[model samples]
Target chain A: MTEKAESPAARTSFFYLAIILVTLILSVIALSLGVTALQGGDASAGSYALVGFIGLALSAYMLLQTQRRPSRVTFEMPQVITTILCQKCGFKNIRDFQRGDYVFKEAEPCPKCNEKMMIASIYREVKEKEKERLS
Target chain B: MMLFVAFIFYGQRIQMYIMIREVESRLARLKFIRDEGRKMAISTIKEIGKPQEDPTERVDRFLEYIAIAPESMDPAGVVWKLEHVLDVRDIRFKDEVRLMAPEADEAQLNNLENTLEAALALNIIYKVIRHFYLLGKKTLSLYIIMQLQMVLPLIMREAEAFASALKAFATGQPIGDGAGALVAAKLMHGHEKRRIAQDIVVATVPLEGRTAHVLKSEGPGGNVGKPGDGIRRIIEETEGKIAAIVMVDAALKLEGEKPGDVAEGVGVAIGGPGIDQFKIEESVLKYKIPVNAVIVKEDIGDAVSPMRKEIFDAADTVIQRIKRLILERTKAGDSVIIAGIGNTIGIGQ
Candidate 1:
């Protein structure tokens, strides 16, 4: 089986994480700047503190959203559909095949013909084209 | 600084909202597909109950079934399996027809079988699609949803191809995939048609100084008859006289590869669960016969859905390649088996 490609969610999450980290780093820089300005008795120290606080809050919210988001999803092989056709009346019915159904095996009775519907054919649905288009 | 921070946060929130909306829309699409699948299934059951419906109605119902079917069922497998059941049914039907009208000829018997098989193949194709489509909906997992989204188009294409193939069979028209057989027919004059296996036919085409045993899954209808069995039988009957085996098939091209591109390789190029490929490999190895593969590249969409103009055009290229390989690889008077490997849905020899 082909490996599942990385999901868009995963790629976007990486970018989100990078933004969060950058914001956190900026907050740390602002915190030091505020501390130094306050020691120097600068009035802008309060503004620096406010900027740092807002940066912290923004990063925290981004982090929370990232944690709450769903990760990339994967899947196993698809299922097969089998059809049983009533030879007597030519009536046909289909369903997800069970473990026991085989080609030519006698299956449930035809609702119309009253004769047993033989497992006329079993086929796997082709889904490759849609996937190709998606990729 | 405060205003800048507020602006950035506002932008982030809007971006997040848009992303969520996209995901929600995707989920909604999945739900829609699932519902469609269920409706198709219901429709199929209804169609089956009415066996006296016209061919166009039957075809429409079958297409509906395929549109909603899940992606797991192999279309080729369904057609191949139906060929078996239809073979038995065809025999019985033929017997009945002959008994009723002793004037029924071989051509009439064949026509009857072809019609039945085509109808069955179309029906099976739709059911298979509905099965997968509904299954995907039921799962409701993002992974499965994405997978279904990808495969649904392919299933639709295959359905269309089968529909066309079925139409041709009903009307007695030649289909496009029979290119390999066409090549064989051109090369070999006075070739006799014989069923090597159920729905698989072979003819002896004499090449320039060599005999080419050409085989294809019987068609002008939907059928990918068991070529593995046919090849095996030819190998056994020839008693090791076969010098080389050439398998020609329509292979799925990777993204960026040109459709109808011709390529050569060694080993069995047959696709699927590898059952047939394994059988061919075993026979070739046991007989010590060299195996050569010639493939006409096509996208997954083109390979199964229908024979596109480009794919049909590739046939001439493939034929030239096969002839060249036969001349270069084997000597005159050496018996070679050339098998056209693919669903012979529409093409006929």
Candidate 2:
């Protein structure tokens, strides 16, 4: 929970390994096709070779990317907010949470009616992931 | 052909190696954050406690404090022993905090205790992961490594939850776990309270023309007082004349369930060492009293984090449910108990 600013995707290593394995499997399939085509004296040998080389090249690129330096993990602290409500005027306001703040504590007078407000609640807002809605 | 042969012969080994590397990286992060949590705790103690002697060594020892498991093979009356062990453990922890932070007030000491407890949880999490990682590596056991890796995400998540709780505890902020206590506080806001049990306070608030004995932990600091003992004592004192028991607490929401949703049901609504639950159940069964529950749903992570806005608003909903349950379950002028079972941090009654 420090204020560090850099973090890679949490599953980066496993993801890279999966990608490498998949690319390797694809390269082998492509190479096997090229080998079979050439041994059969087929006319499609050149095309198979081209596809095989492309697959091999892509695999190398992915492996090189994974071998590069990993990103540092970072922690982002959540911001807590305090909610105040005025009983007389029903005036409600929210502000950044401060030390010594607590629930049910008396706070500044309301601007609307000069009535005192109470710290009704103090909490951090949880940002819910947006859902895809059907029209 | 060579690639195929290699895959056929050593595919699982390669996968195991990759998995180990992944676990290793996460374990490193876990260690770093564990150490960071410790540093925060020590620095906070130093700033607030201002002890003449450095508390680092003492804090480390505190982290090592372990709860002894009571023998349960003889299941009869084991709950009593478990409760006693928990009581002793709780007292020792508080004593430790007091010794290290002699300058801190009661409130500060409670917060310090909470901070240290969270740090201790993080410490234990780190040690477990490290132990398993080293064992897996030393023995070259794929199954052990696989099991550890499988549970690593869950372990890391719990560790992060505890880590986040440190700030809330240190700052005396109400966390999501306090949703029930908030309801109790709101209900008993203008009433006077008397200590009914260890750190528990009960306020007699008139609800719908009946005296509602609303109870919760003494607050403005982090404490989930012994509500079970309070309820049991009240039941005994009233000679089983109580109408009903309406309890409120935060329950863990299932996946995809909205946080702050309120649910009403029957039975005791407390969670923890089961000491409180057992007492309440026994007292209720003996008295033949109907027990009802109103719970605010929250995820396990949210329960430890600072009170979420949704959960904060849900407190009002829980109160509403309690009021409705009382009116429907009890006749006019019949007294009842509304037990708010949860940590009463940053809330007062």
Candidate with best DockQ: 2
TM-score of 1: 0.49
Identify the leading candidate in terms of lDDT.
2
- TM-score values for chain B across all models: 0.62, 0.98
> Where is model 2 more than 4 Å wrong at Cα?
A1-59, A108-116, A132-135
Highest TM-score: which candidate? 2
True contacts kept of 1: 0.00
True contacts kept of each: 0.00, 0.53
Residue B102 shift from truth in candidate 2, angstroms? 2.2
Docking class of 2: acceptable
Model 2 steric clash pairs: none
Q: Rate the local accuracy (lDDT) of all candidates.
A: 0.60, 0.86
Those runs of model 1 whose alpha carbons end farther than 4 Å from true positions after fitting are A1-135, B1-50, B53-190
What clash count does candidate 2 reach?
0
lDDT of 2: 0.86
